[model samples]
Structure formats: C-alpha cells, structure tokens
Target chain A: MTTLMAWRNLRQDPIRFAATVIGIVFAVVLISLQTGMLLGFMKTSAGLVENAGADVWIMARGTSNVDQSGLLNESAYYRALTVDGVESVARVVIQFSGWKRPDGGMESVILVGFDPRTGMAAPWNIVEGSRDALLAPNAVMVDRLYADKLGVSKLGDRVEIVERMAVIAGFTSGVRTFTQSPYVFTSYNNALRYTNVEHGGASYMLVKAKPGVEPAALAERLGAVLTKEEVLTTSDFASRTRQYWILTTGAGSALIMGAALGGLVGVIIVAQTLYSATVERLAEYATLTAIGAGTGYLNRIVLTQSLIAGGIGFTVAAVIASVLAASSASSPAAVLLPPLAIATIGILTLALCAIASLLAIRKLYTIDPTSVFR
Target chain B: MIQTPESLIVEDAVLTYGKGEFATPALRGVSLTAKPGEVLLIRGPSGSGKTTLLQLMGAMKEPDKGKVSICGTPTTGLSQKRLRAMRLNRIGFVFQFFNLLSSLRAWENIAAPLDIIGMDRGAAEKRAKALLAEFGLADRADHFPKQLSGGQRQRLAVARAIAHDPPVILADEPTAALDTENGQAVAQILRDLAVKEGRIVVLVSHDHRLEPMVDREITIEDGRVVEERGPARPKSNALRSTLSALIEARRAASGDGRGGSGARQEGPRISSLS
Candidate 1:
C-alpha cells in the first residue's frame, strides 16, 4: 500500500518526476558513452600484444611496455632455442615510419615485421589478398580502415615508406595503434632494411613454448639466461603495455577523472530534483503519517519511487548509449557499451536517487502527526 | 464471572510543561472519572486547559505526575510503545480542526487506523465505507479532505475516530469547525454512541449549546474542576453560580484585562480535567 501510495503521488506530480528522471537518464547516457569510448581506446593501446600468437615475448632489460623495448640481436633466437622446453623463436621488429600517399600527403604508420614461413605474428584478419603476398620483397599490408587514408586503390599498388617504396600486399581488420595510426605488416628482414637497422638483428623476439611446457615456467627459465628486466610472457607484455600507457600517459587519468566528475554532477542534479519534488508533497506524507503509517513504511514508499525513477532512467540511458555505440562503430570513436558499463550506470542511477531522497526521508520522520490539528 | 467499568479514572494526575522558571503547569493534581454510557462535556473559556486534558485522556501526552487508567489499565508506568498500543486499541481522538489526512480519500482516512494494525485492505475499506455511510458521508467516501466541505470533513473525522470501535472516544471541540446544523449532527452521533452503545464519550468544547445533549457536565477553571453537574441538576442559580465562579477564577488568573493569562493558565486545568 505504501509503495502504491508513493507511485500514485509521483504520478500526481508528473512534471517534477519527469524532470528528475530525464536528468538521471541524460547523466547515465553521457557517462556510459564517454567511459565506454575511453575503455575501447584503452583496449586499442594493447591490441597488438593481445592478438600476437606467441606464448612469450623476449624483450630488452628494464622494458616497461612491449612498445618501448630495446632491440635484441637476431642471433639471440639461437640462444633462445638452447633454453629447455623452447619450441620455436622468431625475431620481429616494430618501428614508426611515415608513408607517402598518392595524394602527396604523408600518413604515419607503425611497421610490424614477422617471419613469413612461420606466420606466427601475421595479421589474423585480412580484408583483401593474403599473408603469402608478404613473401615478396617490400610487400606490405595496411589496415582496411586506413586504406583510403593511405591513398591506396588496389593491392598491387605501391606506396613509399620512409623513402623506400613498397607494394600494398593486403588489408587487415582492427590493425590500429595507440597513436591513432595504421599498422603495415612486412617481412622482418624487409622492415630492418627499410628502418636502416643492422641486418641479422631484430627489435624483439617472440618465443612459443612446446605443448607440454608451461609458458610461465619457460619464461622463468629464459629469465635465468637473460636479465630480470627481459623475457616476458604474452600476458605479462600486454599488462605491462596497459600499465605504461595508463601510468606514463595522461589519457587514462584524464578520462577517469572526467567520468568521475560527470557521474557526481549527474547524481547531484537528479537527487536535488527528486528532493524538491518530495518537499512539494510534504502535506501528503504528513497525512500518511497521521493515519498511523510507520517511518519504515513511509521510507519504503519514497525509496520505491526513487528506484522506479532510477530504473526508467537507466533503461532509457542504456538504450541511448547503445544507439550511439552502434552508429559510431565504424568510426575511430568506438563508443562501446560493455555489459559491465551498463550495469555500472544502473547502479549509479539508483545511488543518485537514494542520495536525492535523503532530505525527504528526514523530513518525513520529523513531521509531527499532531500538527495536522492546525 | 467478569466485571467491567463504564468510566475512565485519573488519580492525582499532574501534567506540567517545561521545567523550573520556564516550566508552565498544564494540569496540577487533577482527578476525575466518568461512568459508562456517560457524556462528560468539559466546558470553559479559551485556554482553560480543555485541549490538554483531552490530549492526556487520549494518551497522546502523559501527565508529569499521577496515573491515568482507562478501562482499568494504569497508563502512567506504561512504556511509550504500550501507551501507543492502548491509544490505538482503546481510545479514539477527534481534534478541533478535523485532522483528516489531505491526501487520502474520505474512506481511506477512516480506514487508516485499521490499516495500521495490518487489517486486510478490502475488509478495512468495507468497514470504513459503512462508518462513512453512518456519518452521512457515503457519497463523499472517495473525496479528499480538501474537496469536502468543512462540515463534511468534520463528520468524516468523527467517522475515522470511531472506525476502530474504540471503547473511549475523546473529542476536542469536534464541532468547533462546523455550522449549527453540522455541529448538531456531530453531537447527535456522539450522543448515540454513548447512549445506545454504552461507550464513554468525553467531549471538550466551549460551546455551551452541546450541554443539553450531554448526560453530565464537568467545568474546569484555573487548572482545577470548579463544578460537576448532571442531568438531574436544575438549570437555576447553582449552575449560574458555578459558571460565574469559573469566569471570576479565569479573570483573576489572567490579572490583565486581556485573557492572555487565561490561555497560559488553561493547560493545567485542561490536564486535570483529562
């Protein structure tokens, strides 16, 4: 009955109720969308590491993230083979270089080199052509999303990378970097030739463990021969990459702080509106109390009203965020709403409603039932 | 096998407000009792402690000293929870201003007490409807207090007070807000509840016209009872003398030509009467 009374009271004041709910919905949608986009971008920062088909990555000592590792000698591959439980070791090189487009514009790109025969770190998703094309000297693969940006029309077309010409061998999906640049895959030897690095030496080494061997145990054994700052598993590398980007770069902190502020503002505005509505209905509450309604009963009514508003607001906000994410799917903005994000927004909306009704609950408790005599 | 009393008892009831110099006495060493099927009409000028006395009898407030026992239960030592229970189960209160909840409809307002006690909604509603019908408010059962006329609202308040069928009904100026026709109707309802149902009905009001409808009258002055008259008491010099004494006592307590002191001093008299 108390809940029914609360619902009826809220219905009676439609304008106020609607205003508070709309405020909460707006906040939830905005925060959810912004936070989702931020997280999506974070995932992109560690994309290469996450997708690399290797059990372990052997990098230089004191390396914070995979992207900032020191180069190792190509001969290190043979040394890695001598390690017990080691299956295969491949030398890879990654470097940032500018590509000259047909439109006479320059597009910055990250060059990733891998062994063609093993295809261990090859682009897993190809939009056009195949990984075999990379066998050709100076043959390169550009991301599908960046094909037009790189001004390439056909797979056979050529583009200049750091003054060295290369053929557009294929296109791949989701091959993006933290710098918002496209990735171009080529032969490790070819990448070394293009970047002017000494022959027979690569930037890093990716090691795969045998079927019976554990990667962590292999990594530990490899660490004995190498320095403590070198040799990491794929998981370790990815985590390190994420940590470096979040700690050294301001992007993570900025996004989190902005989202926090947005959530606070949203909660305050919605709560204040709800509280005002409750104040306007003071007489109605007093009447209920005078009629022998207990404080718990009255509180249930108010809380139910708040939760109802929160549920409605959260649903509307989630729907709006979903639409935004859908429309922005192809864009670099990548507004993605994970289930956790939606659940968080729902919790936030309920909390905001609860905060807003604090004053109303106190006022309800203080009302003297005998005051109705006046 | 069992004996039941018709009246409520108050032994040496002392109700004081505040403490020390700021303390103001509302009821001072007052004792009174009314028999079953009796209508005790407490009359006095404004601030003669009439309302306070009614509040004490209703168990809304406790006297600072002495015990108030209604239906043979001592209320002085009762915990607040128990006192509230007593009020809910035994006593019904009707305020001067017709304290009906503004949000609820007439029937809902009347059913509130029953609802508080976990009564089924449908049963309580049915009972409230019947009570409203008895009070001539059947057509206004769905109307909110703000939508009803003053008299209709007052009648609804009466219906709500008695909806739980409490043994004692304490009304503080129940007809103060009503016109003569509505006031007579309300008084008649109280009279019927007392005479026909054998319930103790205590009505506190300054309106002397209601005296005729009551079976007995108790008048208070200076926080003490000045007179107790019954239906057998002739309406002659004795009644006039008691009335004049009450007026003089009120004037003396006021000190000033204005009746401000009478208002301040009325609390104790009212408490005593309760």
Candidate 2:
C-alpha cells in the first residue's frame, strides 16, 4: 500500500518529479564519465608496465616508478639470471626522443628498445607489423593511435628519431603513454645508437620467471641483490606508476575534486526541490496519517519517490556519458565506461539523494495529523 | 421489542488541556450513558466543549480525570494501539469535515473502515456498494471526494463510518455541511441505525432542528450540561396516552417497526423510553 501510494503521488506531479529525475541523471552521467576518464588516464600512465607480461622489473636504486627510474647497469639482467627459479632477463631502455614524420611534422615520443632475436620484451599487441621488423637496421614500431598525430602513413614510411633515420615497419595497439606521445619500438642497438647510451647499460630490466615461479617471491629474492626500491613485481610497478602520477601530478586530485563538486551541487538542487514538494503536500500527508497511516508508510512513500527519481536521473546521465565516450574514443581525454564505474556512480548518486532528502523525511515523520485541521 | 444493554458509559468525565497557570477545562464532570438503540444528542454553542465531549466519547482524546468505557472495556488504561483497534472494530466516527481520502472514490471512502478492520477488498467493496445504495449514492460510487457535492460527501462519510458495523457511532455535526433536505436525509439514516438496528448513536451539533430526530437532547454551556430533555414531548397524561395509541397504530401499520414483534415491551413507550 505504501509503495502504491508513493507511486501514485509521483504520478500526481509529473513536472517536479521529472525535474528531480533529470537532475540526478545529469549528476550520475557527469560523475561516471569524469571518474571513467580518470581511471582511463591512470591505466594509460602505467600501460606498458601493467601489460608488460614480465614477472619482475629491475630498476635503479631509489627508483619510484617505471617512468621516473634512473639508469641501471645492463649487468642487472645477467645477475637476475643467476637467481633461484630465474629465467631469461632482458634489458629495456626507455627515453624521450623527438620524431620527425615523413610529412615533416615533429613530435616528442617515447622510444622503447628490446632485443629482436629473443623478442621477450617486444610490443605484444602489433596491429600491422611483426617483431621480426625490429631486427632490420633502423626499423621501429609506432602506436596505431599516435601514428596519425605524428603524420606517418604505411609501414615503409621513413621517420627520424633523435635525428637517426628509421623505417616505420609496423604499429602496435594500446601503446599510447600517459603523456599522449607516440611510442616507437626499435632494436636495442638502434636505440643505443640514437640515444648515445652505453652498449651494455639500460634504464630497467624486464625479468620473466621460469614456470611455477611466483612473481612476488622472485621479486623478493631479487630485492636482496638490488635495493628495496629497485626490484618490484609487475603489479607493484604499475601501482607505483599510477600513484606517482596521481600524487605528484595534478590530474587525479583535480578530477576527484571536480566530481565531488558536481555531486554536491546536484544533491543540493535535487534535495531542495524534493523538500519543497514535501512541504507543499504536507497537508495531504497529514490527512493520510489521520486516516490511520503509520510513520513507516510515510517513510516508504518518500523513499520510493526519491529512488524512482534517482533511477531516472542516473539512467539519463549514463546514456549521455556513453554518447560522449563514443564520440571521443579517438581523443586524448576519451571517456571509458566500465561497469564498476557505472555502479559506483549510481550508488553514489542514490546516496546523495537519500542524504539530501533526510530533512524532508524528518519533516514527514513530524507531521501532526491534528495540524491538518488547523 | 428486544432491549439490548447500554454499550457506552461515561462517569463525571473531566478533560482539561494545558497545565499549571494555563489550564483550560474543556469538559467538567460530565456524565452520560448511551444504551443500544438510543440516539443521544449533545447540543451547545461554539466553544462550549461539544466537540471536546465527542472526542472524549470517541476515545480520540482522553479525559484528565475520569473513566470512559465502550462495549464494557475501560478505554482509560488502553494503549494507543488498543484504542485504535477498538476504534476500528467497535466505534465509528463521522467528522464534520467528512475526512474522506481525496484520492479514493466514493466506494473506496465508504469501504475504508472495513478495510481497516481487515476485511478483504472484494468483500469490503461489496459492502460499500450496498451501503452507498442504501444511502441513495449508488450512482456516485465511482466519484472521488472532490467531485462529489457537499451533501454527497457527507453521505459518503456516514456510509464509511457505518460500513464496518461498529457497535457505537460518534458523529460530530454530520449534517452541518449539507442543506436542509440532505441534512434531514442524513438524520433519517442516523435514526434508522439507532432505532431500527439497535446501535448506539451519539451526535454532537449546535442545530436545534436535529432535536426531534434524537431520543434524548442534552444542552451544554461553558463545558457543562445545563439542560437534559427526554425523547417524549412534555405533555399531560391524556396527551401522552393519545400519543402512545397513535404510535401503536403506526407500529401495527408498519408491521413490526422494531423488526422484532415477538419480544415483550419492557417499559413505558415514550416517557420511560428515555
């Protein structure tokens, strides 16, 4: 009966009800998209390390994250190979370099160098190229997304990395970095020739374990040879990378604060509207109570109305977010709609509405049946 | 005729609002007894505590220092839940404002008390239709309270109050919102419930026109009863005898007006009727 009454009451005033629902929907969509973009950017920041398929990462002593790692001796690769349950280890060099496309457009890019023969640490998701391409002299792979931005075309196109001419042999997918720069993968010797690094030295070591070897235990065993801040599992490396960008940089906090502000504004607007509606219909509620309705009934009615409005608003916002995400998929600030993010935004919006309507619920509970007469 | 016992008895009831220096007495030691098959009229000017007395009798409000019993149960010590149950099951109320749910139709309003008493919707609605038909509101059964006329609303209210067949009916100026004809029609319904069905009917009003419809009239002034008039007209013995003979003739012509002609008459028809 209470549910029925509440549904009837909402139907009684369509405009105000719709306004409340739309307000909530807008809030939900905005929050979800904002949070989704944040997560997407966070993933991009640690994309290489997160999907590197390596059991452990060996960086310089006192290294914070992969992007901030100092130079490490390439000898760390050989030292890791001698450990118990150790497998093949490869040296990986990462450095910022300038790339000049065939069309004469220049842009900053991250150059990743791996061994061509072993191909253990190569770009795993090639879109139009093979790892054997990197075996050729002065050949490199570019990310599919940034290839257009760099004004590069087919695999045979020539480009210059740090003034060293190279052929665009292929492209890799999902290799775009947090800096939104194009990624170029080359042979270790080519990277050394371009960056002028030592022949046996690199910035980090990508270590894969033998079968049945736990990454965490291997990382711990390797930590004794390296420092506590040097050796980390793939998961830890990715986590530290994301944390570095969030804490030291301004991106994470800004997005969160913006979402909070939007939610606060939405709650206040939606709550005040619902409260005013309740006050206007107070006499009707009192009449119901006078006729034998309990406080539980009134509470159910108010909450049901709030939830209905919230559901409508959240749905609208989600649809809007999806449309925006779809249109901006190729953009740097692409909105990603994960199911967990949607659910979280939904729960948050509902909580905001429920909390905002607290005063209205109290007012409903305090309505004296005798006051209707007055 | 079958004589049922009294269902409600109030003794020296005193209800006072506020306390200390602000105490305002609404009912001061007022005593009344309503037997089954009786219409008790409580009449007073505005602010004369007529409403307060009715509220007390209905157990809607408690008297500060007195006892009230309905259907042999003492209401003073009852919990609010118990009082509500008693109101739902044993006492019917018709307010002057009609108090019909604005969202419900005439039939739904009439069936509200029955619903409160836990009757199924189908059964309650069926009873409600019958009651509406009884009150000549069959055509208005599907109309909401806002769509009904003032008289129709009052009739609906009366139908709702009596739908559950409670033992006692407390009406506070049930006909005040209606015109003379509608008011007389409503009064006839109350009279039928009291005299024909043997239910205790207590009506509070300031209208002197309703006095003839009640079996007894009690006039109040400043929260106290000032005059009590019996059902019989004040007349000489010869006049009383002639009136009783006329009433007997009418009863015979009506063929058992009380609906039970096999039972013996207990007392004087009119003088002792009060």
How far is A123's C-alpha from truth in model 2 (Å)?
Answer: 3.1
- Model 2: per-residue lDDT, tens digit, B1-274? 2222335777788988889899988889888787666788988888788877776677655778788887567789776666656666666777777877776778987776665556788998888897777777788889988888887788788778777666678888888878887788778778766665556789988766788888888888888888988864344677445434533443354352322221212221111000
| lDDT of model 2 at position B72 | 67
Per-candidate DockQ versus the true complex?
0.18, 0.17
lDDT of 1 by residue, A1-374 (tens): 66656676677778877887787777787788778877776777777887778888888777776555677875677778889998888878877778999777998888888877566677868888888888789999988767788899788888889888899988887666666667789988789867856776776778889998999999999888765338888888888888788657877777777777767776677667667766776665655554446677678877888888878888988898888888876665566678887887788778877876776677777765555444
What's the true lDDT of residue A113 in model 1? Answer: 88
Writing each residue's lDDT as its tens digit, candidate 2 over A1-374 gives 44555666677778888878877776776687778778887887888887666789888777776665677775677778788977878878787788887778789888888866556557868989888878888999987778788877788988888788999888887665777566678888888887856888887788889899999999989988765338889999888888888667888888888788879878887778778878877876765564455566667768777777887788788888878877766765657777788888888888888887787788987776544331
| Top candidate by TM-score | 2
Residue pairs with clashing backbones, model 2: A25-A313
Report the first chain's TM-score for all candidates. 0.94, 0.94
Cα error of candidate 2 at position A309, Å: 1.8
Q: Give me the overall lDDT of model 2.
A: 0.74
- Pick the lDDT winner: 2
- Residue ranges of candidate 2 with Cα displaced over 4 Å: A100-106, A115-121, A153-159, A173-176, A247-250, A372-374, B1-6, B77-90, B105-143, B162-165, B193-199, B232-274
Question: Cα miss at B266, model 1 (Å)?
Answer: 40
Docking quality level of the chain pair in candidate 1:
incorrect
